[model samples]
Target: MSTSSTGVLVLLGAPLGNPEDASPRVASELVRADVIAAEDTRRLQRLLRELGVSTSAAITSYFEGNESGRTEPLIEQLYDGKRVAVITDGGMPSVSDPGYRLVRAAIDAGFTVTAAPGASAVTTALALSGLPCDRFCFEGFAPRKDGERRRLFASLAEERRTMVFFESPRRVADVLRAMAAAFGGERSAALCRELTKTHEEIRRGGLGELAAGAESDPPRGEITLVVEGWGGPDPEDATPEALAAAVARLEAAGTDRKAAMKEVASRFGVPRREVYDSLIDRD
Candidate 1:
């Protein structure tokens, strides 16, 4: 539990939204460490105030903008055998945040690294998603640009394991729309917003419905989206009728007819002409 004995770096997982979620060991490290590297010093200060814990540790800002520059100096402190604790504003350090570089540097310099585990939004959202959690993958954040986002979802169209993603409130609708286009409108998904917070909302439905809901009332606060993966047989194994049906479903969900055909073609491992022909014949 003591960090001052050697070149030890403690990575503490702060509460996602609730201050009470912080563990007792994390509070101890926050107060007793020689140096504290925080993603947002103001937020860290707020957390300390909420916990009513005081620390004599030297606090330094270590975020995306300065994490690289701060890594060397923090590593030096660790090399000097000073206890250094890394903490993010929410969730675990280095988890879609700024602790990877410092942790890697400390390990390279033979400093021991440890963690004070606490609440995680990823697992929390996953459990609340009500999707199959037996096998799942966390996609840190979806791309911002529409093209990039569509391509990303297109690439994962065949993924069988449940997929989790962190998205901004601004792009929630766009992400959902792209997901519907690539994975079909009937694909199950859950949108978890402001998790563990006062206004937490979990909207469960097909991608199309969720996208429309987000468009109508853009959600605020942190957003985590959980999507059901391709649990059935491979797309290539699907019948011609099935491929046509997929395209029709996407088109019905607001996807362009041609775009839906293209996505279905790519997903089903069939030629674009074949998909188009099937849809045309059915029509």
Candidate 2:
């Protein structure tokens, strides 16, 4: 397509960590674009410096906070026959960044959108995770609230494909705890931190074990968690009724009945009320 043609978006992938990881096509597009929409202009400049590529394109900020307001100006530039290239601080734009809105706007405006794919933590971690990769789902980040996080993990308890998630260091332990409770304490998983960086670390173990490890020392840097799919429930495990009886036993052992029922409900993947009703039905 001609450089001056309206409605064209060039999505370029920024370097994940190693500057050499930037693709040749991405460099070419960055140099040739008429307008560059970058998540961080300083980071973009640094990337260009690292790659030895010079760009004189009019650069504008496009990030999470202002993406909505900036989409119009970007679309206007595209409509005015300027080739607009969008890049995030690292990784491909819009995968977990703020470029989706502008891309969608451009598409609705009949623009041609294309990408120069490069490094991604999602696939990078998945490949390094030692988990099944044939089929997988990327859940970027779980809800922060405990109740919401629990519900979110609970809904995915039966997912068959390997699951990947992005989590911050601060909440990694809590997230692991919730995953352990929802997916089973023994579910195998990999926690990949700081992929492609010098201090990169990968911890592989059961969810409960990982949670305990995180408790000892919270992880640092970006993290990608890869969890194995459900292994099917144990056939010989206690039934719901039997589980209620066990809860009663725990209560008789001095545990609060309500709390015991809640724990049983979580372990058995049922509602607390259901476990309570089971206990009543047994009585």
Instruction: Give the number of the best model, judged by TM-score.
Output: 2
Residue pairs with clashing backbones, model 2: none
TM-score of each: 0.84, 0.84
lDDT of candidate 1 vs native? 0.87
Q: lDDT tens digits, residues 10-111, model 2?
A: 999887778899999999999988899999999899999988989889999999999999999999988899889999978889988879998889889999
Instruction: Provide C-alpha RMSD values for all models, in order.
Output: 5.6, 6.3
Q: Write the per-residue lDDT of candidate 1 for residues 1-283, one digit (tens) a residue.
A: 2445577999999998889999999999998899999989999999999999999999999999988888999988877778899999799998898999998888888888899999888899999999999999999998887767766786677688999999999888888999998888889999998888889899999999999999998999999999999965575566778878777666555679889888888777788988878877788
Model 2 lDDT-worst window of ten = 230-239
The residue-level lDDT of candidate 1 at 248 comes to: 63
Candidate 1 colliding pairs? none
lDDT for every model?
A: 0.87, 0.86
Regions more than 4 Å wrong, model 2:
241-283
Relative to the unseen true structure, what is the Cα RMSD of model 1? Answer: 5.6
Give Cα distance to truth, residue 170, candidate 1, Å. Answer: 0.7
